[model samples]
Structure formats: structure tokens, C-alpha cells
Target: MASSRRRPPVEAPIAALRDALARIDANGPVLVAFSGGLDSTVLLHAAADVLGAGEAGSEVESRRSLLAIHVDHGLQAPSADWARHCVGQSDTLGVDCRVVRLEGAPQRGESVESWAREARYAAFAGIAEEVGAAALLTAHHADDQIETFLLRLVRGAGLDGLVSIEPDTMRGGLRVLRPFLGLPRSALERWARSRGLAWIEDPSNRDERLLRNAVRRQLVPVLDRVLPALRQRLPQTLAALREERDRLRELDRRRLETVTEPSRSAPGRAAALSLCAWRRLPAASRAGVLRQWLALHGARMPSRARLAEMLRQLDAPAADGLEIRHDGFVLRRYRGQAMLLPAAERSCEGAASGFCLPLRWVGERRVEVPELAGVLTIERIGQVERVEPVGPVKPVGSPGRPGLAERWLQAPDLELRARSGGERLRMHPGGPHRSLKKLYQERGVPSWARRALPVLWAHGRPVWAAGIGCDADCIVSKGVRYALDWQPLRRSRPASAPERSQH
Candidate 1:
């Protein structure tokens, strides 16, 4: 009879992980995302062995702190027990453990899988921040990469999507390190069994309804039987794809540099480019530039169909001022230039119409208007005793009167509102009144943004419009001039104000 003995420990997986970690060279502390699964268990064990727990006579040189973080998604019945199991296992290994309990369920129309992943990563980011760890490790192995590539291929993803699962990348200000990407799942299982490590088996993993499980159970087995060399070939294919992607990205970067213009109103946001300049590129290069620009602004790349539609719209005669909405942002073309703005800023879209907020601008220097999403500043200019009319001295309300400063101070409390319709402004004192619509059209303001642009009204009369400047009726004498500054708030809390544009 054959001997009933256990197989010897496999050191290849552990060795590979050590080499990957060394190459990563994390300068600060490390946090492992311990899910109490076989792959993660092996990862946690290898990490603890390589990064000692500051004990004496350890083989590891660095004494950096090591911690395990388990996120309880609370989707499974045994999830709580799994968390406890992870904590216990980490304790047994002399590593600190943290269990983050997620609150709330996935919203309507949200995929449970995507929600779980987003929540899990959010928890990891928070823990990494709390612990001041520089690196966050996960146990995504070769199998996961293969499954992802296969899934993306089936979904008809582009080159970047095919190579999405990177070995190391930055996420939420922490270095997200996947050290086991080169190691296979079988290697991890062997290592775990050799060390007598305990782990939980998620029953949901066996459900073929999930695409990953379906691939793992049905497709991978068939692929293994039919083409045994596929596993080796897939990685090589991905490496070549990555090289090609890098070349295309470098070319796109150079092209973007030539056509990009700094946003005059929003700093650190997506830059603007002339439609003429964008159209000058080859069709393929145009798509690449668009992808790179969206990536720079942290926006998701649009689908190929949507991208083609955008390109088609760019060619239309009316497309010069059209707004194309997609993926939480609005792509607008204004004055032959294309730029992106947040979708929420589309105050005129659907049921959420533009709002009007009252502002009592007496002697205050600054006023914050949430509805318009920006601040207004009134800086008092130095007083002048008497002033002579300069060349082409624009008239205020009266021909012999002062400029904007004196008139603005005499105005009553202002009503801040976005454009509704039928608004008009005087281009000059005693000039013919023109519709705000016509004025905006002539000035090349995108139609979508006109609704969100701030318009200050005193009592019932329009006094100032952002980007258009103070009303000619409200212009004060040359003496004591005050500049009315309108600063638009950024998507994030900006470090500095964006550059202002004066009409």
C-alpha cells in the first residue's frame, strides 16, 4: 500500500513573494488585506515571515510594522465568522489585525460585486491612512489576472482594459501592491497546506452565476485540457500588450502637449483644446488623446461606441457648441474649444433645475454661493477727488459719470441666479438692449454652461454676469474703482484660485 504521508512544503511561492516585496521596496509600514482565504492566508504568512514582528534574532533585516486588515462586507451569512477567523489567524501569527464593518447595502441598479469591491477598497484606504502605512498588499495571483484578462476580452475591452491588473500601483494615496501576481493559485494552495494554515472557503465562489467563477470552473479547466501552454502564453501576450500601450501613451502625451490649453476658470481640472487642433490629429490619435485627457482628470474612459459618437459629433457643423454628457462629466465645445465639466454642474438638466440664491452684498469683501458653486469678491478701490475722462472713456449710466466702482456700491442687495430665459444686458450705456441668449451666443459661451453661469441682479435689474462683466448701467465714475471678482469653486478644494477671464 502507498504511504499515507503529507507532501513536503513548497517554497517557490514564498520565494517569489519575497522577491516581489524586495523589488517593491516599501519605505514605510505595510498592511496586508487579510480575507481569511487560502491565497490571502498564504500571503499574510509569507509577509509575516519576511517582515519580522520586531522580535529578537529574526532573519529579516528591516523591523517595519506589519498589520492585517479584514473588511467585513456583511453580504454573506458567515462573513462575521470569517472576520473573526482572520483576526484569530493574524493573532496567532503575532501580527496586528483590524476588522472594518461596512455599513449600508448596495444601492438600486448597483452591482453587488462592484459595490463590495468599492467598499472593500475604501475601507483599506481608510485603514492605511489611519495606520500611516505606505503599502497596502493584496493576494491577487496569476489566476485572478488570467480571469480578468479573459473577462475583459469577452467584454470587448480596449488595450488598457486588457492590462488593468497591474502588479503595483497607487490607490487612495497608498501603494497598492499585488506581490503574488506572478504566483499561481496552485502554488499558494500548496504553500498554505504545507504550513498547516487554516482558511475559510467562501461558498459564493462556487456559484457559476458570477462571471469569474464561471470562467474559473468552466473555461479555465477546458483551456487547461485543450491548450496546456495557454497559461504561459497569456502572460507573454499581456507583456507585449503593455509595451505597445506604453508606446501609444507616449505618442499621445506629446500630441496632447501641443493642443492643450490651461482652463481659464478651473485650475487643476481638465484642460481645454481647440476643436480645430483636435481634428487635425489622425482619427486613431484623436481617440488616444481623448482617453489620455480623461485619465488625467481621473475620469473613466468612455466606451468605444460612445467615443465614436463623440468623434462624429465633433464633425457636425453645430458640434462646435454642443455638450456631450457621459460618465459623470459633460464634454462641451465652446468658441471652437472643448472642455469637460462635472455632470452635477448641469443645473438645467432633468428635474434639478438651476437655482437662485440671495446675496446681501453691502460692504462685504467676499460671499460664498453654494448654488452657483463659487465665491464673489468686492474689493474697494482707492478714492479719487476729481477725474478727467480718458481716451475712449466708457460712460457709466450717464455719459459724464464714473465707471463700475461707484455704481456697484450704490446698488442694492443682489439676487444671485442662474440664467432661466429672456434675460438681456446692455453692451454699453444707452446702447440697444440685446438678449442674454444672443449675447452669449455671440461671445461663444457654451449653451450648457449658460444655465450655471452666475448672474447678479439688484432688485429686479441684472447688474453683473460672470465672464461678461458688470452691466453698463451699473458702471461707476472713474474715482474709487472696485473690481468685481468671480471665482468658480473647483471639483475639489483647490490649493489656489483659477485664472480669471475678463470680457
Candidate 2:
């Protein structure tokens, strides 16, 4: 049996910090995320004490050099002054400091805290990249982690969100180190006092209206009194959850790799998935796979409810036109595969594809069609050259067939129009003409994607439809030739097609 005597409070936070630093084992200069607050003031001082004053040069001394970065969100009236104060404090510790002033006001519907955090992290990433720093240090302590955990819990977050904050993690290509995560806020305050450190307090911290502040003030005090062991217990729970989350993520990664098909047009994009295999997965596994797929494409994780809805839609019949739109991406199910496309691309679907606009191709290399949300490129090809079709569209002619004929390419002014209706294209020379709708159907082009496809017309006659390629009449001949290529552009536009261009 162990003795039950209470231990005295630690004299300094330096020991814990040094232990944290040792665990990090970074052999490069570190940038401290200084905010002129008690927590960060203590972090900056301890870092300065351990690392020494000036920049460290040798590999052995690299961990000893420290730099401070202060991001002025300018949301509060005293934000500018706070930045200055941070600079002054850094100077007192003989540490190099940089101050970044953010510009522009938060957009409507955007919260101040969210905007500030985004701006702050972006600034830190930029500075870290510029200085080639290996790590960016923040002063998030145990109390802050508890507050975050509580906030996430109230919001019905899952394991990932519950353990979102970690002591060390990579962000924006740099290691984000939270050395004081194991220490309490009171310990940091005591350390600051012992070192005669002075720091400014942000007035916004006292605002209970903010969720974080409410948790920190009202919820934390109550928890401290009723369940004093929560602080210690929560961290242990988070650590266990983190390990479990990582193990699950690794499993999800392997599953995702087996089912994912890479996009040809967009690098780093997930183009399609095996519907059969996806449907066989358990509901939770399906959701995990979807989350991993979206993350691979650089999309934010949707809420649990939203993810459930997405999975339901993905499992629905193909005729249902199952496409679920989320904050940054759209889960599109077509034919027998699943695709995660940018939300902007969702507008290109449906009845909007019927709207038509015509543009003159004046021998330029590229033409930007804002209405279609894509660009068309005109490139000359040799007689023997064969141009493959883009995306789902198949090649127009037989194997080894050339692209658009040189004569057609030289047409004084060729018209590039959108499919309106009742359009006919001769897919083979001397062959019967077929409706554009039938051709699109035969090519497996999604109905929503047809409107965005460019149709090249020569003398009021349909010569080629992007994706389907040049018509039989426009096949490349034995002379100078060119191929018209269409590439989609990413932009924020209405689902409805733009009004007819005056040109």
C-alpha cells in the first residue's frame, strides 16, 4: 500500500517543460506562438531559459534557439496593442519576435473566434515556412484541453474531435508542439509569478457568451469542485482514445486504398469507388471510409449526422441522382461508382446543362467560359496523332484515328456552343446522324455534366461535343490538324447557367 500524503506544488514549470522539449527532440529552431497572455508568457520565458538568447547555429544547439510569433487578429480594439506588448515581452527575454497583422473583417455569418483561429494558424504556417522552423510551440495547458474536450462533447463530436488537441502534432508541414499540455493553468501562473513575468489579459476571455469561455468559467469550476479528478482522468481518457483513433484510422486507410480509384484530371482527387465493395462494408466502416476518402481529397469532415445522411444517399438507387452536398465537397454517386467532387461542381448538374452559350474560337490557345465553369484549349495535331477524350467521354473515331481536320480548324471563325437541344452529330463519315442526347447517353455522361460540355459547331452544324470528341465529318485528315480540349474550372457560381453571352 502506498502512502496518501499530498505532494507540494512544483516550484517551477521548467522541469515539465524541459521534459516535454526532450520528448519532442527537435533538432531545429522552434517558433513560439506568443499571444501576450500568462500561459504563453511562461512558455516564452522557459523556452528562452532552456534554449538561450540568440539564434542557435550548430545542430546540437538548434534546440536551444527560440523565436516568437504573434498574430494580431485585430478583432478586438486592443489587438494592436496586444501585439506590441507581446513584442516588448519577447524583447525582455532576449528572444526574436515577429508580429503579423491580419487584414479584412470576418465575412457575414462567420464567427469572430473561428475567423481569428483560422487567420492565426495560417499566419503561423506562413512564418514557419519562411523561417524554415521545424516546430511551432503554443502554450495550451491541461485546463484548455479539458475545456476543449467539454466543448466537443457538448457538440456531440466523435472520438476524433474528442481528442483533437494533442501535445505534439504536425500542422502546415511544421510540428505544432504544446509543451505545457500536461501542466495546469494555475501551475503556469505560479511559474510566471515566480519569474516576475508580466502579461496582458485579453478582455474577451471573460465573455461568457463564447462557448469556450462559458466552459472555462462556469463548467470548469463546477467540475473542479464536484469531480476534482476529472483533469487527470480526462487526459488519460484522451490518450487512450487517441491511440484507438489512430488504430482505427490505419484500418480505414488500408480499406480506402483497396476501393479508391484515382482521378485522371485532378491530381490528389478521389475519382471513383467500387460500389459493390463499398456497399458490403458495415455502416460505421462505410462512414469511416467516406471520411477517409473526403480527407484524402482535402475536404473537411462532416458532422456525424451529415455523414450518416451521405452514407444513406450513397446506398440509394442510381436513378435517385444521389448527390449530397457538404461544406466543401459533394458526394456524387453515378452508375456503379462513388465520387467526391468539389461543391462548386455540383452546380454543373441537372437542368442547368440545357442552357447554351456560343463563343468564337479565334485561334487562341485557350478560351475561358465562365458560364460553363471550364476552359477550352485548341491545339494543333499531326495527321497521325491521336487525342484521347477527356474524363468519361470516349474517343470519337476508331483506333489510330486523328483529331479535328485541319480544314475545320482553319474555319475563319468556329463557334463553340453549349448543347441546347435537338442537336445532331454525325459520329462517322457518311454514317447516319444521331441526336446529341442519344450520343451522351451512349457515352455514359451524367445528365448534369452534359450542360457543361462544349459543342463545337461549323457553319451551324455540330462537328464535335467535348467528352464525345469530334464528329465523323470533323475527323483529322492527312493535313494540319488540331484537337479541342475541355477542362473544368473551379469557381463559385450559381446552379443555373449564366445568361447568354453578348458575344
Instruction: Go through the candidates in order and give the clash count of each.
Output: 8, 4
TM-score of each: 0.74, 0.72
What's model 1's lDDT at 50? 79
RMSD, each candidate, Å? 8.3, 8.9
Q: Over the full model, what C-alpha lDDT does candidate 1 score relative to the true structure? A: 0.72
Worst ten in a row by lDDT for model 2? 494-503
lDDT of 2 by residue, 1-503 (tens): 88899876544666666666776554667889999999998888778777766234312322456889998877789888898899888887678899999998777877777668767777887777777776777899989899898888888888788885788776535677787888899989988887688999888899898889988999899999999999878888988888888889889989988777643223224457767778777776887788877766556567678888887777776633776786556776666777776665556545345555555455687887766667777776556544444323236333454677756655655677777789887765577788888977775666666666778777667777777677766665466666667776653321111111010
Cα deviation of 312 in candidate 2 (Å)? 2.9
Could you give candidate 1's per-residue lDDT for residues 373-454 as a string of tens digits? 5677676655545544333223222233343555545556657777777777776666667777887665666565666677
Which numbered prediction scores highest in lDDT against the true structure?
Answer: 1
